[model samples]
Target: MAVELALSADTVRMIVQKARAVSESLPDTYEDGHEGDLSFDTEKLENVHHHDGLAEEEHDDFSESELREIIDDLNVDEATELVAIAWIGRGDYDQGDLDLAFAEARERSTSPVSTYLLGLPLLPDYLEAGLEALNL
Candidate 1:
């Protein structure tokens, strides 16, 4: 989608910075039994991170509830744009797919932003790449 962004580069940058800070503040949600430096294998990290047998990753130090509140504070347009950025960053859509991605983001947003975003380890990188892709 060649549509213009409702969010500016500065705003997206701010979001990326905040998300990175939050990720740093949080402890490892996954426990891979090994010690020393943690290898961030995204798929493995998410897959094994379960409470009981269910797929429920743990949240530590970082207040997901507070994060949710932070994301919830944004206007609907801002939120939808954020999700679109994530989708681009994740390669679910290319930069050309902006409008379609944004529409899908709006449709797929059945959960809170914090829950959706906090799950991704490379969110800041993705957001940054997405902004670059958009030339913003």
Candidate 2:
């Protein structure tokens, strides 16, 4: 089956690159297998507690803000597709479930897509994995 993305592969790659810079700039505070993890899987992004130590001021604002701007600039359809890709990468949904993931992303989104995505501990990795899964 052929899957199409509202967001281009180049754009996704750029986001992943920028997000990786942001990820590299931040301190590593996440741990694996914490109780009450909000993420879908255990080993993937792991527990949210790892992000507890990272205050807003702790991250590289320039890089993060750049990424935020890029994400925020995306149309709702593109943003929703981005979320679906991440979900696929994070194992919340399989490649064949792209449509379902997109639906869930759109239906479940309550906050800014940028805010929700940037909040993920392993955004770059997940996005990269998502790209690979989609064979883009």
Candidate 3:
């Protein structure tokens, strides 16, 4: 069965792309524990003076900020569905239980949807799985 959404497919696709970018880049940028080290690297500092700008790999602020903006722009129902979709994707709920998922998403939400969604490290994968499950 095809799942209909008030939110456009293009919007969801764009979100998926952004979420994937952020998720993929997070480990190297945030979890590596070697990015902003300023200990005793005099030679590295010499090379840094020659560089024009900060390296892209050093941060994912753009993608992550864009994602937060996109989610923040979504209406209440749209955001609720998005949460439900992620839940479904993560196997917390099934396609047939979409309405139930929606209810839970709405009822259980204590923080902003974007905050909740962004906390999930596998958000992109879950969203993709949810979309496929819904045959969207």
lDDT of 3: 0.68
Better of 2 and 3 by TM-score: 2
Per-residue lDDT over 19-53 for candidate 1, one digit per residue giving the tens place of the 0 to 100 score: 77687765554347321221122233233312231
> Per-model C-alpha lDDT, please?
0.62, 0.70, 0.68
For candidate 1, which ten residues in a row score worst on lDDT? 48-57
**What are the clashing pairs of model 3?**
none
TM-score of each: 0.65, 0.72, 0.71
Q: Write the per-residue lDDT of candidate 2 for residues 1-136, one digit (tens) a residue.
A: 4478757777787778778878766644334633121222223222222222222333454477777766776766777788889888999998888989988886775566776777677988899899999988
Best-to-worst lDDT order: 2, 3, 1
Q: Please give, for residues 1-136, the per-residue lDDT of candidate 3 as tens digits.
A: 8888865555666677778877765544224432221111223222222212222224445577767766766666677778888889999999999999887776775566676777677888898888888898
